[model samples]
Target chain A: MTASSALPYQRLHVELDARRYPIHVGPGLLDDPDMLVPYLAGQQVMIVTSETVAPLYLERLKHALSGDGRDVREIVLPDGEHTKTLASVERIWDALLAAGFNRRCTLVALGGGVIGDMAGFAAACYQRGVAFVQVPTTLLSQVDSSVGGKTGVNHPRGKNMLGAFWQPRAVVIDTRTLTTLPARELSAGLAEVIKYGLIQDVDFIAWLEARMSALRALDADALTDAILRSCAIKAEIVAADETEQGQRALLNLGHTFGHAIESHQGYGNWLHGEAVGAGMLMAAALSQRLGWLEPDEVLRVEALIAHAGLPVTAPASMSGDDFLSIMRLDKKNIDARLRLVLLSRLGDACIHDATPSDMLDALLTDFPRR
Target chain B: MTASSALPYQRLHVELDARRYPIHVGPGLLDDPDMLVPYLAGQQVMIVTSETVAPLYLERLKHALSGDGRDVREIVLPDGEHTKTLASVERIWDALLAAGFNRRCTLVALGGGVIGDMAGFAAACYQRGVAFVQVPTTLLSQVDSSVGGKTGVNHPRGKNMLGAFWQPRAVVIDTRTLTTLPARELSAGLAEVIKYGLIQDVDFIAWLEARMSALRALDADALTDAILRSCAIKAEIVAADETEQGQRALLNLGHTFGHAIESHQGYGNWLHGEAVGAGMLMAAALSQRLGWLEPDEVLRVEALIAHAGLPVTAPASMSGDDFLSIMRLDKKNIDARLRLVLLSRLGDACIHDATPSDMLDALLTDFPRR
Candidate 1:
């Protein structure tokens, strides 16, 4: 084992009734059976990963999950945000049924957010829900998507239009996996880590500003700390609102605008985190217009996003009308009101369904484009 | 409105803590706006029905759910068990998104088991679940699938393999709809009605034996009583075990073999209740071999199923091997052990995972065929 592999892990729990699970973050959790095995529902284990991740870590994950006389299987799906669909989830279900995996089977999702969402969704609907564990191999999933039980696939009409609130039995985040993540992807993940600070932790924003360089350099401590703090904040919010009925919508601070970009640009083009980074800036700008954030706070948000190597501007091709069209279809919206998570202040986010169309149009039309 | 429209509805609650819902049974309940509107989650109501039932009742249901300025919409899917698919469910999600239905929007399932299961499964996963109500138009759904939250579509390899346990806001069973149901479907529905008696209540079995003619003839009073009793039994069981941990398996008394038959026969060829009818008899015969039921008891089970006009024999084309292969894939099995619910006695069912291979083989090999 490498010297980095011996780093001690930190564990956090998402305190959900009956569905409570642990989030284990460290340098080499992928190789630790003790971290993954106890969470398995039964003898059956299905490791659902993407083609991009299989060669890199699938075997080691299987190795860690092996030797318990378990029936271990793997399904390598094509990777990318566009591939997040019911058809992809069906393939996972098909593989499990083909393998004769039952309700007691556990699905271990071993890739980034797309893989985690699709595999976790498959586990949710497979035989009316089975236990699943998240072995997120990307920084984005490790810090954000993997921590929550939100599992679903995107629809042609909107992102995450089809899914379930299926919590994982455990979340295993091995910081070593980040070393294999491309710099752009790591930056995408940093967007969500930044989101935690922007939404609920102002001090975390300062902490991130200090450590952005180290995080970009793949410093183990910096990345691990970011993941732990981000998860802790998310775990608390998700525990309060497991179904996104209320406070949990705060997590989608930039997601309303981000999803529109993703949907309009077509999934995978901008990457969810990249779009979210830009969307967060748009939200901050809107918050400024609403007097919720100072002009300096908006600049701080932009500086942080740019420093993290994320996009600071919306896609040039998207029009104000385009944003409204796609944003109208957002799942967060209830009835005729379009709900967007905005900053009431730094370190505090609020769901706003009463945004005036003219103000939103001005922001979308006036927002800087790439 | 018909005189039967004045029939007082009986309400039964499936006590599932926060997810608990009521099942209302009576004739002409569909035309009563009071029955459906109160259960809807919001002003946006999406009515999911089949082409077969749309011409007959959609207008009335819409009228009842309208006038309150509710944006009630409808999607008429092609009817049949073959159409019970993720693709069909995607169409539902697509329609919901197309209509801009939000998280609080309600999906009203307005057909038989196939429609109820598909729409409920759609609601279970649409934006991670929305409120839904069951407006069951057929007997099978009214007494069974609509009461419990076991909603899903069948896979090519298995029946109801992909789904979730999402309870409905209410179940509105209008006995008047059964007046237009085909004679064959009425028999199919009776199979499940008979199952409730066979699994847990011998007195109900005797009561059914006396009332079978009345039920088959569509006697409103007899039908309502059967519906109420069946739903009460299902509600009690589902309340105790919402996710089918232990006692819920008793409800699947004939479903293991039934699903095998359905899968082998190709879904939609034999109605789900028809397959269950024959499968229940098979379970009885197997129970006799296991010395749990006397030969006369097996005959009584056969007589009841046959009297209900359901098949008393397995399909002529299927072999012992076909049944074995399919039954081996039953979801109730765990860790390579095949679990089947068999009769412990009249009105009492037991889950058996230890039936001797030779005995199961002999029963399968010697079982009567059409």
Candidate 2:
């Protein structure tokens, strides 16, 4: 019990000049209008969420967003990562036009990463861009996806191949929502939370290791602390590089290989964070091979990922060639060069595009498979 | 021949802070790599054109774009206004990813408005946006779409219902391409060129009246002069209001009513500029009813549209109610009020959200149907 018990919420800002926005982490934030209404671009508010999330939180959010002047509407899309497509976003744009929503309309994304990414992309292109608020529900979104403003849908050839770097007006994260999240989803989110520790904060990694059990058990303080720290690390890095021109690529610590898994398995087959969990292990192993990370460091990464209930190895069906083929299309690669973010040590990461192909082939071929 | 024959090209810049770019109006620019290569973001270039224009200019443009270390690929889409959909943009994204084009790649839009719009939008979202240049061949594109950076596709619900305000790196308008254009398209292009005059340039309107015949007959000097003046005016307005927030809406003087006609008739059935031509006459007539214009002024507008060989009346299939319903959902409308960009006087326009429903009803009902 600390001041968090009395305050009940923690707030942080992503410093992006005129586009800067706040991320609020707490319990029971879904029912609070104060955290949302101020950031809306205008009176037209459209809440976009998935079928899985609407029943759990829609009415409460609608009530919170309701006002004398505001016009509130919602579209309940089918659930799952497979639904993250241009067609779903088209449905949003169609509804907006049908409802006569205009340039001043604000989109409120009220689900997990799939919902947030799709809703944010819809807002980015709607009327040549409008305002949107992210009311992210799931641990993965609360910690990572909801903060960076990386919004888009996956293509058949790749995951998140089509997207825009459109920032949100605000992010409202409710720890209470995690209470209803499936155990697998909660663990999936922990992968990204652990990623923050592995990439930039060694101390935070130790902190997460000690408190992983408490977080899994739905301990409010632990969840709030974890989300706040993860978002702060993200906000800092994003502030330094808003468009992924430089340091921002470091945040994709395991995403290149992770995206390959997601794209190959079909988007909805594997959870994003789950794919990233195994990807982080692969990155650590490769770093050790490069003499940048110790063998013991790789083991610690695997152990933490395992403790988080995330996959520690690649899918068995995917061969080295499949991974290489899919990874070749990762958005991070420039001018035909494959770039990977690898751990130089426990607390730091570097983007290396000069890895020896034979060494990469050996790692992909010999790496443990589940 | 004037000074035009001496230089062969005229240069103007759209001042958008750091995003400022040039608009080059000339004949035979397709074979001049010097006009394009300087703006290329990298060695990778994807040329997106329509099938109709590919046979005419694709190889010539490719020859010019070809150079040491440059990688150029082309995707020629099926042509037409109806083909403007997310599906087309997806195909563009598919080809770019297939080629492993990176963030540094540049997309060259090598056709009319439809091609420029789709290519520009694909560039806006590919790998979270890459650089793109406008190689607009049609007169309408050279003078309007290529200059303003209003890139998008029409939705089933409305025209240009999906898009982004992604500016191009440069606009290369080759007057010679107009030689291959159909007579109807040349007239359609004139409708937009006429719009610039009616909206902001009284002198240009007078100049156009004197030389409409020369423009229609493809007098190179007259065409070049018309394109330069139109682009210069559009660039000034766009620079002042990049997004259609305030003064920019003035640019849509006939567009609100024009879009209604396009939507009602289906996009491809009516050329955008033809619908706008008839729509502009409707606007002038409505202005007369409001006591803003003389009856002679209305006739003058009608004659100009007729002189351009554009439709001067609404589609026969559309009823006033049909127009009203579609106009209700126009992006410019706010709070259920229908906003119309009406001529306050010749060469000037205003966005009137308070148009009495009865007056609009009368105009829609009394306006002649073709």
Chain A TM-scores for all candidates read: 0.97, 0.96
Maximum-DockQ candidate = 1
Question: Please, what are the lDDT tens digits per residue for candidate 2 over residues A1-370?
Answer: 2233354688999999988899999988888878888898888999999999999999999988998678999999998877888889989999998987888899999999999999999999987899999999999999888988899987766677788889998999989999899999999999999999999999998998899999999999999999999999999999999888889999999999998898888876788899999999999999999999887888889989999999998999999999999888776888789999999999899999999999999999999998
Model 1: CA > 4 A from native: A1-7, A316-319, A356-358, B1-7, B265-269, B316-319
**List of clashing residue pairs for candidate 1:** none
Could you give the DockQ of candidate 1? 0.80
Query: Which stretch of 10 consecutive residues in model 1 chain B shows the poorest summed lDDT?
Result: B1-10
Model 1: per-residue Cα lDDT over B1-370, one tens digit each: 4444476989889999988788888877888877877788888989999999999999988988897688999999999988988899989988988887888899999999899999999999988999999999889998989988989998877678899999999999988999899999999999999999999999999999899998888888999999999999989998998888999989998898898898888877898889999999999999999888999889988998989999999999999999999888777888788999999999999998999999999999999999
TM-score of 1: 0.95
**Candidate with best lDDT:** 1
Per-residue CA lDDT of candidate 2, range B1-370, in tens?
2233354688999999989999988888878878888899999999999999999999988988888779999999999988999899999999997887778999999999999999999999987889999999999898889987788888776667788889898998889999999999999999999999998988999999999999999999999999999999999999999987788888787888888888877777889889889988989999999999999988988998899999998888899999998888887886667888899999998888877889999999999997
Model 2 TM-score, all chains together: 0.92
TM-score against truth, every candidate: 0.95, 0.92
TM-score top scorer:
1
Please, what are the lDDT tens digits per residue for candidate 1 over residues A1-370? 3344466999899999988889999988898888888899899999999999999999999988888598889999998988998889888988998887888999999999999999989999999999999999989999989987999988777678888999999999999999899999999999999999999999999999999999999999998899999999999999998887799889998998998898889778888999999999999999999989999999999999999999998989999999998888776777778889999999999988788889999999999997
Any idea what lDDT model 1 has?
0.91
